[model samples]
Target: MPVMNPMQEPCSIMAQPPFRSFLVPGQPVSHPDHPEWGEGVVQSAVGHRVTVMFPHAGKVVVNATVVHLTELS
Candidate 1:
């Protein structure tokens, strides 16, 4: 008799499957010559610029290219 393996179901929208990258609000950012946009929440993602809310600077738009993604600890 041959044993059949169980099929795995696809991941749902709510479930963040492995091997995929996603962005969320309230993430830190950095850039040279500018004050650390430390721990700013992502307000909106528009084109190449993303509007982020800093702790003391309030809301400000930053170039998406300038924002470096941090590795998950």
Candidate 2:
């Protein structure tokens, strides 16, 4: 039997910002297309957008400036 090396593939370069400890209070986050899928805490923020992870829906990335969010104590 002969041994073979693993195949490699090229991927797109996505510029992501560093994680910061900041949360806005009473922020409304909604999806660009579907507003009903928008709900939950701000899991992470990147630039003008934040990843909203809901308890029932899951996760949806939305604009931080538009979504009204609040920090949970």
Candidate 3:
């Protein structure tokens, strides 16, 4: 069996109805697990990886599967 790279596969977030509705570029999000990182703007989302630009942490790549980022208005 060949190992499937997440980056090569279609984003699962986009396939799921609920997650697809909200996960978009430029969306405001906050990490619940890492509150100290502060609020961040969604830079990009691909496959299972989401790039978020945080005030204190700069650009950080988070695994969407493990971290449920809260979308803020």
Candidate 4:
């Protein structure tokens, strides 16, 4: 049997309503779970994963579905 690439597979979560509020690159964000990390800027947003650059925590990858990152105005 051929193996299916997960990336190519359709993500059901992406179709959900809350998924519409995904963040984009360069957007400022803050992680409530890790407030000590301070505010961070979104470096990349792919699928359900987001890479954020935090001053204290450095680059961290978080699950968009679970994290619910706060967008900084």
Candidate 5:
């Protein structure tokens, strides 16, 4: 079988920030669509994608455009 290699970007580029996103690392948030995931802490936020560490759901990536994460105080 012929070996295949994944395509790589010519250059690295920064992603555009999500509109009206106030999420940050270590900030607590909850998923409105999936309450079962319970309260989660923000692991990383880049562009519209947010990495949340949930107690029940473990680590999950969510799109801020589709589901607005509820920020906890």
Candidate 6:
């Protein structure tokens, strides 16, 4: 007798999961110009503008295209 493989779950047939390319609210991030601001949590992201709240620098809006904010783990 030959052994049979188990069936795949429904989720396994779905397309690839969402890529983490876009930053969402509450996600931690940092900038190059003001590293002193430390890690900031994203408040909102619209088009090329992103608003984040920093621990020392408070809230600030940054142009996403101009600054490449590093995503924090």
Top candidate (TM-score): 4
Error of 6 at 65 (Å): 0.6
lDDT of 2: 0.56
Off by over 4 Å in 5: 1-20
Instruction: Give the per-residue lDDT of model 6 (tens digit) for 5-53.
Output: 6774555547765323378999999988899999899999877788999
lDDT of 3 by residue, 4-73 (tens): 8877865685775543334788999999978898889999888778999999899999888788899999
List lDDT for all candidates, in order. 0.56, 0.56, 0.84, 0.89, 0.86, 0.85
Candidate 2 lDDT, 5-66, residue by residue in tens: 56743333345454443554334444444546545666666666677776557876665566
> How are the candidates ranked when ordered by lDDT, highest leading?
4, 5, 6, 3, 2, 1
- What's each prediction's clash count? 1, 6, 0, 0, 0, 0
Candidate 5 C-alpha lDDT tens digits along 1-73: 6554667543335464436556999999999988999999999988788899999999999888898899998
Worst 10 residues of 5 by lDDT: 9-18
- When 2 and 4 are scored with TM-score, the better candidate is 4
Reference-based TM-score of each model = 0.44, 0.41, 0.67, 0.71, 0.70, 0.68
Q: Which residue ranges in model 6 land beyond 4 Å of their true spot?
A: 1-21
Candidate 1: tens digits of C-alpha lDDT, residues 1-73:
6555577554475495433224455555533344565556666665556776767678877665655544222
Instruction: Order the numbered candidates by TM-score, best leading.
Output: 4, 5, 6, 3, 1, 2
Assess candidate 5 and give its lDDT.
0.86
Worst 10 residues of 2 by lDDT: 8-17
lDDT-best of 1 and 3: 3
